[model samples]
Target: MLLICHAAYARDTSSDSILAGGTLKPTDAFDMGAGHVDPLRALDPGLVYDMGARDYVVFLCSLGYTQAQIKSMLLPSPGVDTSCGGDESDLDLNYPAITVSDLSGSTTIRRTLRNVGRIKNAVYFASVRSPQGVHAVVWPRLLLFSRRKERITYYVTMIPLKRSQGRYDFGEVVWCDGHHRVRTPLIVHVNTTMDGGSSSGSLGGLQVA
Candidate 1:
């Protein structure tokens, strides 16, 4: 069997230099290079969130884009009109990271993970470290992967407890299975407006092999 590897680029903070104020700051773009262990560890990542071309179409649809606009963006565009019927909200996109640009009150997002580890019976447990003023809840706290590339779905709901302290709040959701840990960052942008507006966003990370 042929083995293909993908390298992960990590933010190399070691290249950061001390500023006049004695604060360390990154002075070069190359500072965000790959970490030593990122590639090796990424190869056998216990769980990975996978996405396809159609999945991206659904995501664009969730962004409230017109069918014409979407078609224009598609290469060798389809001859027939495409619709985003039955598509979930943009927040529910199957991505490693969770982002809510216009959060108000409470909102729930869904994510799916695929087991890509060597072990067929690997199990994982979910944990969260919520940011200030935001509460996170993950349904079906435990996941069971009995076969390679098996998929599982879960939900994360962010509830705002108080007024916005700043423009953004950060958190993370992690899945652990004795050895491997799959973590995804959570970013929520507080919008006090009642209209519940939306923003354009993208997902970044590795895909399952």
Candidate 2:
């Protein structure tokens, strides 16, 4: 078993979960964010999160990296601009997973998916598993990709309900189109009683049913 490292295919699902041993430290996603890999299903992942090199520069900028330092990481492309003009928010990066710590109130998470499967004209719908003591909803419940590599943006709003503190909750948002299921886990540490930090009241999209 001492070989090269592997990556976790899915974010978090009890269907294929392995329990942790110790009694004191009950199994939690923090213990295993990336659990394991499935070779067979990796071939056709339906909707995948894709980003360009400039996105990394933007990510770094969001992380408070200086203009000079960020410029060094980029290859010597003459006409490229590395300025962080309008970032998609720190947590709004086009990642497959979403997490919210110190969540004071309702928060809206944005994610963009690129169609990578053979089916160009695929129709996918949004499905959510709300974490304990939290209300989760996704906008534009329906997604239709006309061509391969087509990218679509979706927003997920998480509202905190009355609950316990000092614990992190787990949830997920899955996009299914009959054959393929693309899941993205939503990990949250609800701090509704916290001092500051605000969330968006808008759904960011037209429909929210």
Candidate 3:
């Protein structure tokens, strides 16, 4: 077997996310909404740098799964666990020590992992602390199965804290290069308490499959 490593740019258009209805801050372009609350205020202003990081789609797309299907999986389920270590009262989080502008622009964000990424199971874990010192965690997964010529991407996200019910939104992973800058246009809107479970919006032509 040949172990060939390759990079690819895959376009996935997802069912519209309900978390899409929010205000995007102009200063750094962060999404703000009912669920997008911040609780990390005790830290020093120097540490205010720990606010959090998020990436919202600059555009929208019509793709895989109907709105109903997407809503079923993306929304919050009753039986799901909302706290780490099985305790919502005791929540702990380690925020990234960097800011959006600090990331390297030259580095490219990988959308898919060639053959393995498409076949194997994938998960996205997100956590945040608001200006009030409240912390929460979220786990989003992408399951994949192949059928003939078309490859489908699955999206499933879970929040692990009851307190975070309406204090967080989808966040984007970002990096910056020393010179020119490049980033994936896919932005996610994560809401734990929308009429539906959650919602998403996209920018550029980027869409989740």
Candidate 4:
């Protein structure tokens, strides 16, 4: 059985349902980094594909699921021309924007898959602590592309991050319409104590027939 040792808080289940188009089954509670190492350096990485109306991005290691499973979970959210890691402008329709909070002020980073063309692998950065709390950063060097129509997308992610004395976990989630609205349960987070510095986590999944 696949068990994820992380604590998950249901932000907006209804909104998530609307984006996923169905129910979600998550892994058991699991810890990130503590001992596990980032697996996306050369083995597993992130990926994206186009499916006619909607585009799909497979964040392989986000929840310990495979690229096939990730894509399957996102069957509901579809559209746009899939692109990643090459030209951020290519995916300008709506980029994956992240809002990070720290001691200073909150900073928002727009991550467009257009940088790497495609996700091949990812790495974790050093652990950083702020007034918001301890944060584990997962950085990936990936592979991205554009797909047309409904297609079966496949990929893998094996990155996990480690924290301080308190427990920590990491996962990925898809937020559409707005940040508060999320779906597909691909979001990564740590749920335990902080032991060490930074660690890496991966995310991947695929759409099957």
Writing each residue's lDDT as its tens digit, candidate 3 over 1-209 gives 11111111112135323243355223222432222222331111111111111111000012223334433444465543222122111001112211112111111121221122232232222222321111211112222223341222222122222223333223332221222111222222222332243323332333311
Q: In model 2, where is the ten-residue run with the lowest total lDDT?
A: 1-10
Q: 1-209 in candidate 2: lDDT tens per residue?
A: 01111124433366644666675454555665534566766666677787776667777888888779988888898766688765546787776678887776777877788777788999999888988867788988999898643888888888776443788898878788998877777888876642233223546553322
Best by TM-score: 2
Give the TM-scores of the predictions, in the order they appear: 0.70, 0.80, 0.19, 0.20
Model 1: per-residue Cα lDDT at residue 98: 81
Off by over 4 Å in 2: 1-16, 21-27, 86-88, 194-201, 204-209
Report the C-alpha lDDT of model 1 over 1-209, residue by residue, as the tens digit: 11111123224456534232243553221232112247677767677777766677788888888777878888875554457786548877676678776777567788888877888798889999875566677776789888553888888877665446566766777788888877777777765533243222212221111
Model 1 Cα displacement at 119 (Å)? 0.9
lDDT (Cα, 0-100) at 90 in candidate 4 = 24
**Colliding pairs, model 2:** none
Considering TM-score, where higher is better, how would the candidates rank from best to worst? 2, 1, 4, 3
Q: Report the poorest 10 consecutive residues by lDDT, candidate 1.
A: 200-209
